[model samples]
Target chain A: MIPAPVIAAFHPPRRTLLGPGPSDVSPQVLAAQSKPIIGHLDPLFVGMMDEVKALLQYAFQTRNEMTLAISAPGSAGMEACFVNLVEPGEKVIVCRNGVFGDRMRQNVERCGGIAVTVDHAWGEPVDPAAVAAALAAHPDARFLAFVHAETSTGALSDAKALCALAKQHQCLSIVDAVTSLGGVELRVDEWGIDAIYSGSQKCLSCVPGLAPVSFSAAAVAKIKQRKTPVQSWFLDQSLVMSYWSGGAKRAYHHTAPVNALYALHEALRMLANEGLEQAWARHKAMHLLLRNGLDALGVQFVVAEPYRLPQLNTVYIPPGIDDVAVRSRLLQQYNLEIGAGLGDFAGKAWRIGLMGYGARQENIALCLHALQQELSVVI
Target chain B: MIPAPVIAAFHPPRRTLLGPGPSDVSPQVLAAQSKPIIGHLDPLFVGMMDEVKALLQYAFQTRNEMTLAISAPGSAGMEACFVNLVEPGEKVIVCRNGVFGDRMRQNVERCGGIAVTVDHAWGEPVDPAAVAAALAAHPDARFLAFVHAETSTGALSDAKALCALAKQHQCLSIVDAVTSLGGVELRVDEWGIDAIYSGSQKCLSCVPGLAPVSFSAAAVAKIKQRKTPVQSWFLDQSLVMSYWSGGAKRAYHHTAPVNALYALHEALRMLANEGLEQAWARHKAMHLLLRNGLDALGVQFVVAEPYRLPQLNTVYIPPGIDDVAVRSRLLQQYNLEIGAGLGDFAGKAWRIGLMGYGARQENIALCLHALQQELSVVI
Candidate 1:
């Protein structure tokens, strides 16, 4: 009954979404975005959900029994993983090298778990030695939390080494692979990661909304034996499991965003066809292209070569140049979008993402030319 | 890059989305849904955000300075309202008439607030006199929380009377108008409601991923003076406001669901064209038509006429009838979706939603015919 208003559509100049995450969506994914929304539990939608889960498993390299998409964005995925796995009064060893790691600490604390933080410099990955030392120090720790790829600083951590450290201390490991899953090599099972969560954006190239999460058999058992009920009834795995895992007769949680799921399924299907290793290699190759361009323009990377993520490249701002103004000009003039540094490096660094569909050589060339023009004004 | 899949051009089915919500999206809104994704802070997107705020103000009948859509769903909106308003040790009077009200109570408790509940029968509206009495008894209560419309039971509460009572007692009112919004007449300013939240589904007829929320100046002041920090950094209104409010420069909160906002903007535009009063009348008339059809069959309404919501209609299931079987038949054969009764009313009731585009005459005829065919054996 709503009368149609003559509100005009506000179309931004077609910019490459080359940010830390939510990279440029493929035309097919964008078309999937317009699919008719069906009921969350509609048989057709449920079929789509099953396919999404299967594709997510392929990307994460995990055979975990509890693999599904959280209804909210990546942040809620972090909350769900921590709140469901970390019980009240439990001690959690959280490794913090960047913003996402700090987010993990916040999640653990909000869940009433005492956070034992192992702090690292912003651009550095979580050192396995430091994580092992922290695990040894906190003998009563129930979980070890770390980010696999630090989106804020483009640092890629050694997830396998950290998981091994947690295993040595008899602690379940929770991994935040929000910016990792498809762009990098992540073998959840081989690395002994008990719990992991990822975003649909970033290398997955899906529009941002759902969070793909997985829990190993050990983590599910821990949830099963929890002494008290989870505070967040909405995000509780036990309740969510009935809806996500049970076939045919799924319980109602919240209304799933049916169209978004269709898009995610399409994006994941695209990933499946690309082959996980091939996708990872493609991302790395694209990163090299971007790196070469930036280096040619005298822009050095913030993170060293060996540790940096291929998708998210953090670079220090040149001395005396206004970061915001340069980014603004690039956006307004050339229709290019890049990321500003987060937290401590806020005014000092710029993050250029060569991710997913935005990772094409054409986009890299376009960005280089645009940045060169925009930076000439300030530099 | 995502591998190209064979993407069929989107031509959504013209079904009546009449279950709980995502009530028939209009063609205009569907077209809006396909608009290209833009950066969350793109100037054009920011301008669109302004229009969205203005439209929301019209829909909620408010002039509150803090009004914006949460990037997540209705549940997240519920969480935001609680996390920001009800700090630990605060006392909140929660009126529980149905499922969503119970959910509010859960949020309050999880936020470490003391929830003093005013109970009502599932199919009945909340008693304003009871709420007044509770407010009088708990004079120290900081807020009164209640649902304006109970979607699960198809009941409409006296939101104006309840808000008046809360104001008289010098307490803030946190209202859940998720189901009532657009379908029911709500005057946020006239009712003196301090804080209110709504969903994108229901009468809005958009998708389900966004929640529109608003806060009065008084409510904003209360939040500004809170002693303890909000537990959820993400949902904290203070943080979200910097991005949502049209300040000089928007602070980054999280990536806004770009294309989804386009769909919501289009829905609001439609609402703006159709005066709110006219829209309300349309919903009422549609409900009347649906009632006539239901009466022609052997079905009886679970919620009585006086308190019934025109948008959601709960009907009693006859004895010996298989509720699941009938719902399955409706979905499989008719491709028509209706809601199963929630909580204690499960298997006892079927909720038929006459909302937005789903409230048309053809939809009513289709729904009635489908129900008649399925219920003939049981009745």
Candidate 2:
């Protein structure tokens, strides 16, 4: 037997999360997680699960009965949509503008679907014209998948346009709203999204782990038409829905992450209380605050103004600035965390986030002042 | 667009968790989850991630380098092992004695692996002799999978012997340690377990949603030699290891469940401090306490004493007793949760769990008293 290693209790220091995700969680949501855990199948827990489903529908602006939280993060939720809706040998057209867009192509291929890529440069939105062209070319494509907001580049694609194109082509739409959900204007029903997934930590002011997802009636129809069972037993939406969908009886799926759901419930409750439109407006206001300050500091944005995501701001590092050193110092000295550029943008840009509870005047002012002092020292 | 649903914040009433899983979490572990949220990629959070790996190693008693927690629940962890190591068309021997064991068969089938079943009665332990016979019968089988502790039936199969039989047959062993990890004697290295997956909610006294998994070098070699990519992108261990493995640079895979991981780390730390042997002994001691009390109440155990698990005790519902009424009243009136029988045992048995923090003298006393009163009323 290996001797037990004595480890101390992990006590994390307070950090101001201005990074791409896991933005500052409200104390209410955080405290909710510590509340006593109940059985996943308990009558009370089942009641709460119903509320969660209704609230998620509101958050996504959809009336889809298939709305529920996946037991894992956004990635698993993304996989759930693909594995359930897309069969082997099926064709899927994926828009690749950033890291998550590329990930969508991977999900397609992993599940034995053929993926045709529609490429866009980082820091730019998925071009609707290019999507239209791709859809026209791949008329047999069963699905069109893309990221609504590219977290890696702070680019906001026109989801409404993309979904409309998918509809015109008679293909189901799969959208990754991981970084978009509560921070901007997104209506799953109105925009005609077939299947969509979002993270709990990104714009919900909840801790990471749970992924909120919804599927339109069309998406459910596609899943039901599949001749083969879903490839992933854990992510099989048909089985998972038996537990999350309010049926006469709840069957045992995997044990739901009880405490994490508590946090998500509190986060969604707060979002509804604040109202979705108001939250989106607040995110835009905070982005403007940070944007003006960055302009005064001589830092340029990576994305064009009209295409940018208010919650995720990508800006170029000042010439001759050490990317790692600046981020390190900010973390150590100011207890502030900003995201280093990801994928194609690595080491060339920085991502500052204004999400959920973190989208406040105080957070924006602190971030602007910190960058000003750091850049001056480097110069 | 769906209107926002005005839902109040969920405040779960304090309940003593004694069900099959999601056992009573320690206040310390619960409080750790509520600590200020940190960035998933934060330097400090990464440091804590290292501690979690080490603490998990102690809990599983394995020195395997492939140890890490899946961001989802144990079901995902189970799928991770199968999708990574079990290639399409490969033959695998699965010992089916309970729900989890049958689930393992489903995983193998979903991955396109042929599963050879070795059947056992629901309440009985997996007979090693039968496993050996199955292994000999299926010489081309590349893997042997079974549940270490069957949560559905409270049957404790001899994992060490089963793993040895697999080794003798030139087959790798995969174990479901969901209910066994911290509560029973599990030595992943000594027993030659090629792959193992466990749950946080079962015996770690942590919140549900994270699955701790480890792979032996042979298992890693099998994964590396896979002719085809893992079917599920989200559960793919090779890509996931790039983010989890202790390498010079951590790659971003998915957002780590930040707060949920904190709870896991704290739970594991407490396990290490208590010492694994001591925890095992305590579970045994508490099991005997509950066993004697149940006997005095004329309750008979589902599994024989030799094969029964200490953490989870399955007892046949006394004749003339109503299964749902007793469990419902226990949940609604006493706020004490005991599991209803699962699978074949449904409506005939009750699973009373004395797992992790819930394995206490007080819990045993209350459960016996409540069952006694309820049984008399039914009579």
Candidate 3:
């Protein structure tokens, strides 16, 4: 028998999280999460879910009726899109510019689909020309999967152009907007994006866990025509559709993370209150503000200005500085949290996020001050 | 284009959730959820995760090193165990007694495993003798999967006896403890349950969405010898092991639902404080109290007394009463939520849950008072 460890209740310090994702959550959203517990199937909660769907459509700028939050994180959302649309033995042209793209390939393979990859350098956006080449090479490919905003590298690819390429090739486009949705300009219906998924923690600034996803009519038709049932029952959109849709008389698919959805609803409400364009502009403006300060500190950005994502800012750690020490001191001394680079860039770069509630003047000033103090000790 | 619908901020009523699951979460757990968001990879957060693991081990009453909470609901947790352990073309002996047991069959098939089902009546527990017969008939079966407590029918099965049957037949046991965990007597190591999954929203009294699961060392060994990669990248425990295990230097798996985890940590801590057996006895005592009151109201239990679940109390809706009307009145007029019968029992029964914090005297009295008033109008 394992004895229960004598541990005190955990009280997490309120660190200023300026990481790659889970940037900063507002107290408003946090409070909504803490509000009295309600049933997932409660009619009132269902009404709130309807509002959540409408608000999500507004954020995504889509008219797709098949839009709702996946009950898990963005990774599950990515899997949902792939498993539903990419059936076994079907070829998918996956574009890999960073970590999430590689993950997409893994999703395709796990779903028994062959992934024909088009590789690009990390910290660089997906090139439409390279994708066009891939599509031409694999003429039978059914789906074109790519990440719009690579959280690993802070690079924002041209999603509109990429979707057009997929359309030209008669391929459904499955896009990962996990870090792009509210912070960047995304037009799902306008750009004819077939399927897309994003996270609540990134630009939405909700507590992490839920993933908002949208599927176009064409994508839904493909799902209905699937030769095999979606491999993962939990991620199957066809079954989940009955639960998240169907107005008030929805069937029980899975017990939703109810309180987490409450937080997401409030986060989306706040996103709507600040117009979509306004939120994107704020993210861009904050990115500029942070960049100006970093320039003075001689910090170089990993992604070029034209391709950089406003919500996520990746920069090279200085030659003389210790990566973990600077980050450790920032956290211990100033209650700050910034992301370490992932995958290929691990230990070499720092990803500083200026996401939804975190894109503010005060946060920028604090991050700059903390970095300067820590870096000066070594420089 | 779907124009953004202008909706007011949602304020969910402080509901007394007496449903099959998603029982009323305590104010303390709710308050913990609303605390400041932390980075998933932060040192402090990682420290808290270790505590969560220890607390979960104590809650499961096991020293299984492969114990952790899945980022999604219990369904995903069920999927995780199946996908990791049951390889393609393997035969699993699945027992169908209620809704979840059927879901397990679906999970088994989705994992490319053939399911040999042993059927029992919905309100009846899995007969150990019947399970033993199935094992004797299917000597080549690699696993036996069954529900420890049928949430749909409020029937508690003999997990210890059934696990012993599986052991005698050289098969691993996969048990669904979604409604049984803290509300009943469950000793994972002692019972020799190879794999088990439970929901947080039930007896744990936490908010819905996270699923706590544990796998014995034998089960882990089976997973290690699997031929195919787990069908789901997100649910792949092999990869998730590096993230939840490995002490301070845990690898990044997914952007964890950081805030939801804060709530789980607190819920587990509360369970540890209360003592597991004490929680079980309290549930039994509360069940008896509700049963006496329910009897006076002429309510009839669906499950036999010997097999009834203390946490979930399923009863037939009195004849000649509109099932929808009574439940609707209870929710609308009295701000109470009780579960409607699901699957085979839909429109024919009512499931009055006394789960977790909702199992107390005040909640029992309130539920009983509300039920009497609603039934009086019809009777």
Candidate 4:
């Protein structure tokens, strides 16, 4: 028998989260998560789930009945959209500009579907003309997949134009709104996105576990007409729909994450109270404040202004600045947390976030001041 | 433009959770979950994750370095074990006695493996002799899968004996200890369990959504030598290991459920403080007290005494008693929650759980008194 190891109680530091995702969670949401545990099939909990779905629809600006939360993280939600929509031997036009787009390609390949890539620069939005060309070249492509707001590069692609192009080519669109939903202008119904997925921790400011997802009628019909069963049982949307659908009696899927759902409900409720458009405006306003301050510190953004995401701001590290040392000092002295660059831009860029509850004037001021202090010491 | 829907704040009712799973969580664990949200890749959070791994290792009674918590629920953990270990066209002997065992067959087939069944009666332990016979008949079997504690039927199988039989047949064993890990005796290393998965909501008294899993070196070797990639990308263990392994620089596999991990750390730490054997004894003693009180109320158990699990107790519904009415009344009047029968035994039995923090003398007394009062009203 293995002996028990001595461990201390985990007291997390009070951090001002300015990361790409998992931004500051509100106290109301955290307290909601601490509510007493209940059974997954409890009647009262089911009622709360219904409210969560309605709130998610409000956030995504869609009236689709199939909108609900997946019981895993955003990556699982991304996989759920691809594996359910694309069948074996089918072609999918996947636009690749940042990390999540490449992840979509991996999902397509794993599901035995061929991914036809439309490549662009890392910090640039996906080009609608290139996507149209790919769809034109591959007429048999059944789906088009792209990230609306790329978390890795802070680039905001034109989801509306891309979805329009997919519709023109008789293809369904799957949008990754992991960093876009509730932080920017996203109208799933207006943009004609057939399927989409977003994370709870990103713009929702909920404890990070659940992934909110939605599907239009076209996507549901495709799932129903699939020739083979989905390769994943846990991620099968058909089975999951029966459990989340409104009814007096719901069939049991896997056990729902009870407390996590509570947190999401509270988070979405707070968002609805604040209003989605107002939340977007707040993010943009905070971004401008941070931007002006960073510009004074000689920090230049990687993405061009028009295409940059207001929630996630990727900026180049100042020349001769020690990335590790400055970040460590900021964390140690100022209790500030900022994101490091991901993928190809590692050590060259830093991602500063103004998402959900983190998009406040106070948080922005502290982040800027902390960076100034840390840079002064390092340089 | 879509208008934001007005939603009320979610205020969950106080419930005394005594269900099949998601037993009553402790206040400490709940408060731990309410701690300020931190970045998943934060150095401090990484240090806490290391402690969580160590605590899980102590609870699982194994020194397997691959032990860590999955970012999703227990069903995902089950899928992870099967998808990672069983390759396409491989043969697995699945011992089916209850719901989770059938779920195992589904997971195996979804992973492109053939499941050869070794059937036993529900509410009874898995027949080790039958597993041996199946393994002997199918010499090409690569794995044996079964549940250590069947939550659906309240049956406790002999995990040590089952693992021994699998080892004798030169096959790896995948054990589901979801309801058994903290409440009973589980020596994974000594029992030779190759791969095991459990949930946080069961005997650990943690909130739902996280799954703790451990894999022996032999299981790791099998996954390493697999010919085909695992079908589910989110459930892949090899990619997850790099993030959970002890190191200064951990790869980013996925953004973990940060607050949920905090709850698990606290739950496991409580278990360590109480000592595993002491916990097992407490569960057994509480079960006996509940059994006597239930007997006075003329309740009959579904599973026989020897094979019955202490955490989950399945009892036959009294003649002329309405299952739904009684359970609904208990929840409405007493704020108590118990589980209804699932699958084959629906409406015929009630599952009364005495797991973790709920396995107390006071809870047992309250459950007995509440049931007696409700039965009197119904009759």
**Highest DockQ: which candidate?**
2
User: Model 3 scores what on Cα lDDT?
Assistant: 0.92
Q: How far does residue B286 in candidate 1 sit from its true spot (Å)? A: 1.1
lDDT (Cα, tens digit) per residue for candidate 2, span B196-257 = 99999988989999999999999999999999999888888988999887454889999999
TM-score against truth, every candidate: 0.94, 0.99, 0.99, 0.99
DockQ, candidate no. 2? 0.88
Least accurate stretch of 10 residues (summed lDDT) in model 4 chain B?
Answer: B370-379
List, residue by residue over B1-379, the lDDT tens digit for candidate 1. Answer: 2223333233335455678776777777767776667677777888888989888988988878898998777877888888888889999999998889999999999888999999998998999989989999999999999999898899999999999999999899999988899998898999999999888887998878889999999999999999987777567789889898845588876767777788889888888787889889999999999999889887899888999899999999877889898888887777788988899789899889988767789888899998888878866
lDDT of 3 at B66: 93
Candidate 1: tens digits of C-alpha lDDT, residues A1-379: 2223356655545778787877888988878767767777777777667777777777778777799988778887888898788888999999999988888998888778899999999999899988887887889998999999999999999998999989999999999999998888889899999999988778888888888999999999999999976767568789889988888888887777777777888888788877888888998999988888888878879888899899999999987788888888888777788988899889999998877777788988888888887666555
| Deviating ranges (above 4 Å) for candidate 1 | A1-6, A375-379, B1-14, B319-321, B375-379
Tens digits of per-residue lDDT for model 2 on A152-224? 9999999999999999999999999999999999999999999999999899989999899999999999899
Compose the digit string of candidate 4's lDDT tens values, residues A167-212. 9999999999999999999999999999999999998998898899
Predicted candidate 2: interface RMSD?
Answer: 1.0
Report the poorest 10 consecutive residues by lDDT, candidate 4 chain A.
Answer: A370-379
Which portion of correct inter-chain contacts appears in model 4?
0.78
Candidate 3's DockQ is: 0.81
